[model samples]
Target: MTRTSSAPLRSPVAALLAVLLAASGVLLGAGGAQAAGYRYWSFWEGDGKSWAYATQGPSLVRPDDGTVQGFRFAVSEDSADADRPRHAPDFGAICADTPAKGGAKRVALVIDPGTTEDAPAGEKPPALRTACAQVAPDASSAEALASVAKPLRYDSSAMICAISGYPKSGCGEQVSGDGSKKDGSGKPTDDASASASASSAPAADDGDSGGGPSAGLLLGIGAVLLLGVAAVFQARRRR
Candidate 1:
């Protein structure tokens, strides 16, 4: 004679595993949410007269004596690939070092031509600084930098990087050492769509500034699909 036991059957460990895996999938989906529009930095180093691209971000590089650090505003290829072709910056012109005149600080700045439409109205750039300008009549970094009497010497302590928006609210502000500056009315001191952030190095610049969806999203989707497959397997095992 066979006797029936009153004990109930337990669910397989696979069911528990499946729940944890699903929770992990949810967390993975949130990884890239911090991306507030993908603007990043590209670094360069200067020979006191000429410049070269940097292999690593500024944070990894600590300039010794006489070493000059340089940075150029690099937009995403999507933004840069249009008619406006930006050449690598000219260090001799952009980083032109001049002795202080009349005990006033010498500052040099370059503006990108593509960003001219964003420039605010009613304000003119200061005249005393050195600017290396592009030959084109249109607005350009070289053309903007050219107006100044002399380009400021590159400093490891402080660097001038380009910020592309006003109120300085995006990637540029994040990189700015001084942070955002407000006027009497709490409006941003910078009215130009494209402005410079004179800040410290060793902070290192970011990469891949474009804000579009690309390979990363595709890979993420694939991962989610794979996780779904795993959940299906766990369900089958529970049955």
Candidate 2:
């Protein structure tokens, strides 16, 4: 009598189990790497054509005449994912009404409070607007912004929390990737209805913020897991 050995089937089963465990490890690692993001205002500078992510903070960069400064508030992982101002950086159009001053510089400002989705709970975003600020020749971008959008709110670290008292409170707080504040029921919370008092403190520079893993990274990991699952099923059938 010839006996068929079960070693072949067992070997494939063990290999499939190892693959499944490795896939779980990948998923956990990916989830940890793609943790949370921050909701804050991202500063930008623009030429006559397009906006550029500012390398230096608004307080450090000095704006020249005809320069355009932009401020966008949204939930972002980092500067790469930051939402830019809605309007274009049109210095000629923004400062067209205001005549140039000899002793002062003309800097156009584009302020976008972001969409309703990005606004804090129980809060509405202010309309996107443009203003031409006339400031001293050596005024920094932050000063230029303050010249127009006054009553800015700052945190203990000097980070700008609210512009024109929009959100009422909170400074660069960490939120879900989608900018939602969820409760135990997995429903969004509406706890942003706080006092509208503005802070009298000076705003500070928000330097380059950090980010987490991208969506593509998570998707790729999921695909690998699915392929592994398929391999496990195939091995079972072979057994």
Candidate 3:
């Protein structure tokens, strides 16, 4: 009696499954890896009452007279997770001391350097304060900021990275999410008691910057597909 060889058939099936499992892992890792959180200044515009995430960067926005511009530095996944200025956007209170000019516009600016917890290692946050900028009627928000917060720093892409040399270095660096939240909830805390002392600054102007699959991800997918095809071909050949 001749015994049929089952080993050869089992080997190909096992190899095929192994290849498929590896492919699944590659796909999962490519898609599920935790995103790196960013530490950067989030821009905002405020009505007299509340803050709204700025849709346009300061360089592009021509803030109207009495417009309130806000900047907050923090570790956040996106603008939605960013902390708003601690104080309310009271344009009247911020610009009260500065009289209006005939040929210029006045913009109230709020700069929050964030808590020490969110500051870069070995760095401390600057005091939070407001500023009233007197700029040309058509001047952009950036111009308005420069009027008070001079010596502003910007990255190669023209993105505002720092205001008044707070951090001193780095531009939108990636950081872990540990201790990322302020007050346990990523919402704005209305610190109405904070004084509206006049100060000034400039900050980041881009929206959430992201990209598609990386080169490594594409290479991993290609390799997995190739191995799967080879295993299937070998299994059929052994028949």
Question: Which 10-residue window in model 3 sums to the lowest lDDT?
Answer: 192-201
TM-scores, each model vs. reference: 0.31, 0.70, 0.62
lDDT of 2 by residue, 47-67 (tens): 878887766666667878999
**Per-residue lDDT of 31-75 in model 3, one digit per residue for the tens?**
444443456677788988999877666777898988999988877
Against the true structure, candidate 1 reaches a TM-score of 0.31
Candidate 3 TM-score, true structure as reference: 0.62
Q: CA lDDT of 126 in candidate 2?
A: 88
Question: How many clashes (backbone N, Cα, C below 3 Å) per candidate?
Answer: 21, 0, 1
Better of 1 and 2 by TM-score: 2
Q: Rate the local accuracy (lDDT) of all candidates.
A: 0.35, 0.69, 0.69
List the candidates ranked by TM-score, beginning with the highest.
2, 3, 1
lDDT of 1 by residue, 1-239 (tens): 77543232224445555665676556554543322211223344555555555544343443432234433433322212212213333444544655434423332333332233222233222211224322223332222332432343222222333323221322322311122222233211231112222221122224432333335655665776677677657665654
Worst-scoring 10-residue span by lDDT in model 1: 186-195
Q: C-alpha displacement of 221 in model 2, angstroms?
A: 8.0
Return the lDDT, model 3, position 76: 62
Candidate 2 global lDDT: 0.69
